[model samples]
Target: MPTNYYKLNLASLPDGLYNQETDVKEWLALTTTSKGSFPPDSLNRVLRMDSSVELERIIGISLWMVGNVLPFVLPLFILASILSSTGLVLLKAFLTYVAVLASLNKFIFAPMFMKRYKRKQLSNTDIKDNQYLHTERNNQKYNSLQFVWPESVNRPALNDKPVIFTAIPHGAVPLGITCYPVWSKLFNDKLCHWTCAPVVLKLPIVSSFMKHMGYIPAKAKHIVDTLTKKEENVGVVLDGIAGMFRSDKNTEIANIKQRKGIIKIALRAGVPIVPTYGFGHTSLWKIVVDPFGILEALSLKLDISLTPFFGRWGWFLGPPQRVPLCVALGEPVLCPKIDEPTQDDIDKYHSQLLQSYADLFECHKASYGWANKKLVFV
Candidate 1:
């Protein structure tokens, strides 16, 4: 049975009950300037109305309805409709056509796309602003580190034999030496017939620049191809970006836990690993400390950073400390087959590479003042 309600008296209600009744005044004031009447219940009902039908109708009219209309467009539409209706064979034909177009795009259009993509990538970064200064300054100094030895010491000849040159800088170093004029001269005059295998050529912007400067991409295929043609002489950065600073009390070279793609490439190529060291790079920039670690974190996240120098110093090329750099190079560790090299072998070679780099750093630290400060790996 339905329930019934009994009426109650409101004559004894308190005046305080009407204290919050300011709505009428507000409504009256609003009505003086507008022709709208308050219809809260009606408005609520309209707002609560289901919109699913309208939404579905709009979507259907845009896509499904438009597709349905395409079949009425004469001979071409008739052929398309017939083919789609038949399925299988027609689908294969369409797929074949698409595959041909995709192949064309891959061979021709993709390279253009990559070049433009790389250009855009470089343009979006601040790598160009300080590129010349940072790269050239470090390259000049580091390259000169090789020339410092007495003529009596038997320096390795730049023969056509493939030798891996690895540069290990104590802290943030510029990445321009792989294609500097001094290196270019060395390659042209001494190692002219010898092809360089710089790992930087594998990087995006730097790779493009390296290619233009006659250094090809350091892919396994390319390295193998070059090695087959002539005995290739390659230069690789051992520490890469990791060697820039110490992390967890160990330099990036010291951290053997990560993948060393360069080491693997050298091993596969059967190239001699030569460890080169450069010091005094940390002195190039004044260290800015952020207590919160916000700025450092942001720089790393964005892959763009500033290393401010106190004053401009003329480029200085240190005498080549071959013993230190060569100590890291040690012996040429060979990996027979480029294709079948194992992960364990790669790891062992990478550990050896790190040890070589560490030895180079330790030997040259005194000369560069890097010996005093704790090498904190970031």
Candidate 2:
């Protein structure tokens, strides 16, 4: 025979009781038939309640919805939508628009967006005003040495003629820097063709930085077309951006887990696979592994980290290790002109590319400080 009011006041009451109370209140508010059912006194009191407190609660609910519920619900909703005629049409139209927008954004709008975003983000932080690094006038001083260039002594020349280089993500080496020197030295010396990914041209600070080093954003098709003119040195990163996972002194190519777009591009373009490695690249920063063990994939996708070289040994460009940090320019594997490449062809080339990388790693293991490390498949 305990009073209902006393039961509501107890701290030991189940959380669900509070939830049920809230639901009842909501239902009561919604289903009010007569004005007196919701007394003017009660309505006035509720209306007069702290708006800031209500707002905070709403925000918390919204954040929970977005962070937890939306991820699973959105995919299911999209799937259900796809099963309907209107939904399918809308989805198709949306996808087409998104694809077009992505292409345009990468090639054009991204640079501007990056610059604006960087400036805004920096302005909000307590960063010091360094005149040399930040000012437009000091841009020339920053251009003293071309940081991005090839280590090869016999660097090919890139005349006004365009040459294409696919920027890959192996050894976590930002090939952009190494490739710059290659382009300038090769193009300046020989005056042959040179080109690279259009995405590079659209990076805010990076685009200008690249242009100064003599690289234009070149399409893959254009690169192949240019190659047909003469024996063109079209460079490509076999392990695209996923190469960033490689641990220091690890001989195994960690990039095999990802898609081999570079292989496809190489096969289509008929370019020789250049198995390259960069020593002391990953040592540039510290990587935090997922603690929960559940979000590792998502964490990698987001790349949630401090600045590229913060709280660790800042990056250093070693004098390119010709042997181990090696660029094994393998013999050109001729590709057939086919409408669709077979899986076997893809697998064969992928294996060859992987073996070439392993061989190069083995050949220079001692010099690069990876002699003791075992080549892990993953």
Residues 185-216, candidate 2: write the lDDT tens digits. 32232222334456545645545544443343
Task: Tell me each candidate's TM-score.
Answer: 0.42, 0.43
Indicate the residue-level lDDT of 160 in model 2.
32
Give candidate 2's TM-score. 0.43
Model 1 regions lying over 4 Å from their true place: 1-160, 175-212, 215-231, 245-259, 287-338, 367-378
Which segments of candidate 2 are over 4 A away from where they belong? 1-179, 183-200, 212-232, 248-252, 289-308, 311-339
Q: How much lDDT does each candidate structure score?
A: 0.37, 0.37
lDDT of 1 by residue, 4-27 (tens): 111111111121221123232331
lDDT of 2 at 275: 47
